[model samples]
Target: MEAESREAGPSAALMSAIVTEHFVLQSAAGTTVSEALGRSSLYLSALSSSLIALGFASQTPGLLLPFAAAALPTVFVLGVFTMVRLVGTGVQNVLYLSSISRIRGYYRTLDPEAARYFARWGAGEGETDDALGSLAVQGGPMAGLFTAASMIAIINGVLAGVCLALLTYYVVTDHHLPAALAVGLFAAATSLTVFFRYQHRRYLKVQQ
Candidate 1:
């Protein structure tokens, strides 16, 4: 039986089933990552807002600058976490897409009636402009904001700016301009660390 199977090879139905199963698994993995990302973002937003509100309401020294300064590292950590989750989700999506592309290739080998089932259902064969393909577009004025990575970066960049400003204010009020400058350096370090450690290898690596 093993020799006969080796000689005949697996049937198209069996291969398609295997590829479809992989696609489903990858899709589920991506969904789980997205859910985790959403939960993390929501919790961070709620906590940050609540802390700001509480700090403003209470009779605290430095006008909430101290609280904001303390929260800066926490925000950085959350941003790094979000970037990691985004990478995981993106990897899953790419794997799912690869599985679908393979399935399409298999379908193309079949009869026309069978091939029509998988024909260009948004995830086309050679087009590749589904989600991240907008990156290839030039001078669209808003093409850069198309991918999930860009959205994550923009949202976290805004949060980082807020945190950095608050930290600078805190340092300047309590210490001096020199101290504020040091805090700014620390903000740059934090962002660079997050980018290099979590995001660069996964998202920005060259495909050579």
Candidate 2:
């Protein structure tokens, strides 16, 4: 009985440690999500306020150009910073989830009977593979575009195009509306493509 108790002691301590670690990872994941949402809210609020101010400025005749010249660039830059941090938080959350999944795998090993309870939890044949496979099927290829970070990116891209259009109208093309529109559309498309590609690469890096 003494020898049996000695063997059990270490196993019990290890399981306790595992449980604590699992809880910590879950908490960290939640924190990352919260941070992402908060940052997104901040950015969106700023963008909306700037737009409203611009709307008012447009009514003042000569104030429109000067106001947009200052406001659009500032808001666009803020959007860039916000989008980048959002992507970081998203990646961090994924990593935390991956760690939690690994810990759950340990739980299954300790109690084979408990595996049934975890079957729906994305354990799959291995720790991460099946979970990712299931996610891919459910989310599809365009799922990344639906994230908060992607939403910000799209808005930022449009802002960039608008800025370029204004510049073209006032400076480059000398108030040619058609030329400004063409340039703006091209800028918007290019910006979106670059943002989407960057996001895809970041996610792929996380998976690797």
Candidate 3:
């Protein structure tokens, strides 16, 4: 009996350690999500306030151009910062969840009978089994575009387009509205494409 206890002791201690690590990872994952939401909210709030101020500026003659020139660039930079941090937090959360899933797999190994109670970790190894994963698979490539980070990217892209349009109107195109519009649209589309590509590359790196 004493020999049996000694042999079991290491296994029990290992299991305990694994369980503790699982809990820590779960908490950390939650924190990453919270941080992502917080950062997004901050960016959106700033955007909203900037738009309101611009609206007021628009009502005043001569103030619109100067105010927009000052505000838009600042807002765009803030959006960039926010989007980067959000992506980081998002990736961090995924990694944490993956670790937790792996720990759950270990748990299943220890208690095969309890396997039925644990949720499937993913569609396959390395893939997350969460709602995001489901959306990505079912919704296809466009599904990846629906994330908070993407939303910010789109908004920032539009802001970039607007900035470029304004510059074209005031300087490049000599106030030619059509030319400005075309330039703006091009800028916005290019910015969005670049942002999406960057995000895809980051995720691919994470997967690797």
Candidate 4:
């Protein structure tokens, strides 16, 4: 049995190393996702703030309305893009979490003794590893309310509101029926966008 034991020892060590590597890779990936989410949020916030400042400095409300109208569609598109990115980031989080759980299961299979390490404090109900998992791989704005998806949603909502208000003001000042109708249409469009977007996200979740 000595020869058989020697062969099995190397195989077991190799399997342990592979499992460790998988865990480390998932951890690293989670860190990268956190970083990207943070950077994207900052960039979008800065850009929107700068544009608002510029619009005000121009000191021409009439001209500003036109420009804001032109920019409205682009802002809406960007918000949608941010939402897509957020969905991807969320998926990554789930995948990493699933991988980690599988690894934990594998550990339990290999050595039942390791189960205590994952226990949750006094419960010993197999919750220790969960506490470890709760530790942040990366923390900052990404972990907070200032995520890219949220920022973009806020910016887009503000833009839609401003555009509608400006259009209404222009209609009142110029007494133009076409402009008034356009304002109504814009309001409808904004409402539809928000409603449909929520529905779409819900659909995606259901699909998953």
Per-residue lDDT over 1-208 for candidate 2, one digit per residue giving the tens place of the 0 to 100 score: 8799765544667778988998998899899889988998998899999999999999997999999999999998898899889888876777787777787666666555867765534434544443354344222345467677998998899999999999999989999999999999999899889888878887767665
TM-score (all chains, Cα) for each model: 0.60, 0.87, 0.87, 0.58
Error of 2 at 185 (Å): 1.3
Give the local distance difference test score of model 1. Answer: 0.56
Question: Cα lDDT for residue 76, model 3?
Answer: 94
Local lDDT at 3 for model 4: 100
Clashes of 1: 0
The order of the candidates by TM-score, greatest first, is 3, 2, 1, 4
**Residue 68 error, candidate 2, Å:** 0.2
Best by lDDT: 2
Please give, for residues 94-168, the per-residue lDDT of candidate 4 as tens digits. 455545655665666555677776432222222222322444322221232333455555655655555565667
Candidate 2: residue 191 lDDT (0-100): 85
- After superposition, the stretches of candidate 1 with alpha carbons farther than 4 Å from their true spots are 1-16, 19-23, 26-33, 36-40, 47-51, 54-63, 120-145, 172-208
Compared with the true structure, what per-residue lDDT tens digits does model 3 show for residues 143-168?
A: 35767799899999999999999989
- Per-residue CA lDDT of model 1 for 1-208, tens digit only, reads 8898756766779887877786786577568557756856764685578567756745766546555556655765666666666666664554455455556656666665866775544433332222233234322223333445545555565557557655566544664666666666666556645554544455333211
Q: Higher lDDT: candidate 1 or 3?
A: 3
